[model samples]
Target: MGESGAYRRLPVAERRRQLLVAALDLFSHRPPEQVSIDDIASAAGASRPLVYRYFPGGRQQIYEAALRSAAEQLTACFTEPPAGTPTQRLRNALDRYLAFVADHDAGFSALVRGGCVTETSRTTAIIDEVRRAAAEQVFVHLGVPAPGLMLRMAVRSWIAAVETVSLIWLDEGRQPPADQLRDWLIDHFVAVLTATAAGDPQSSEVLSGFLAAVEGQPRSVR
Candidate 1:
């Protein structure tokens, strides 16, 4: 048997998954423009044509798919089981997010900064959706079913801060450890919410509930 005959065949779904995994791996380390169809094909142990068969739009399509996958994972980072204080819960979510940023430093940078040659309206929308979803999850954690304008703005601003700091963390070679960064971000969120609570009745209520949760926790936990 020849070398090609030594390989086993993968089902269509499995083949597609493999190709996506390879593409995502490349995208995680380098910008989309630097990656090629042959790179993905070679990384997946397949031919270039097979990649084309899976993604007809070529590199752009593959980049989009990878971006979508990354966005899903990033959004999921904010999804913690409703069990901790608001601060603890946000910390948990930030833990997951920071881990992802550390794992996919290059791709996270590209996704947040957004000047890639392959970027499109669709990709921009996907990024925006991730931010919206994160802010919404944060609101849910704060026990606010319907947040007011100030409350909503505070949450969105915290999300933006997380993105900006994550990018800076990557640039700084992830110094001061992920835990320090996570704690700093949580403190930032608390500061923002506390300041907003001073003038907005809606925000004040939410802040009270959040603080109650934090206060109920053991000192060690805090």
Candidate 2:
């Protein structure tokens, strides 16, 4: 039983996590600006005072915590085993990323779009950290020990595009299926990397490696 129906008090961490899970659930389906402490308390089956006990700053405090937790999850989306080719790893990563977007829905939208009532600099930093972490993971998959400016720009731009496309996918009701979107995104990454290679020798070298690895793989007929 949850704290709401419990006669005995939970340990401090359990209580806090229960409350945080409740907050994240509400945030997942709706904008954080629309979520409140009362909503979380109701969802968690706890009282307002108890939520306040755990998060004295109320909704703002809890929202940041939820965002941080979600950020970590999103950042981990780019991580994959190095066993596959770079594009294969990237496709796997995109599947995970898009799955997260589909799972989070409105929360993912709010997390990237920002401009929420309770959003703070800390929240913004958390989101940015996800972006940077994602880019770094892209570099890792490309086996680039030091990504040049052009390669960095290409990867970051692709990340931003992924975010944009994810929002569009949600708005369109997840049409085209996630696997289709994932394959298309992988193609886009290769294209962007190819374009970057035109100007940067480092990108050219990286692109050569990626293409060599992807040469024999089956790709979408486009």
TM-score of 2: 0.93
Poorly placed runs, candidate 1 (over 4 Å): 1-8, 217-222
- Give each model's whole-structure lDDT: 0.85, 0.85
- Where model 2 places Cα greater than 4 Å from the true spot, the runs are 1-8, 217-222
Q: How does each model score on TM-score?
A: 0.93, 0.93
Candidate 1: C-alpha lDDT: 0.85
TM-score of 1: 0.93
Model 1 residue pairs with clashes: none
Q: List the residue pairs that clash in candidate 2.
A: none
Score residue 166 of candidate 2 by CA lDDT.
93
In terms of TM-score, which candidate is strongest?
A: 1
lDDT of 2 at 38: 84
Deviation in Å, model 2, residue 31 alpha carbon: 0.9
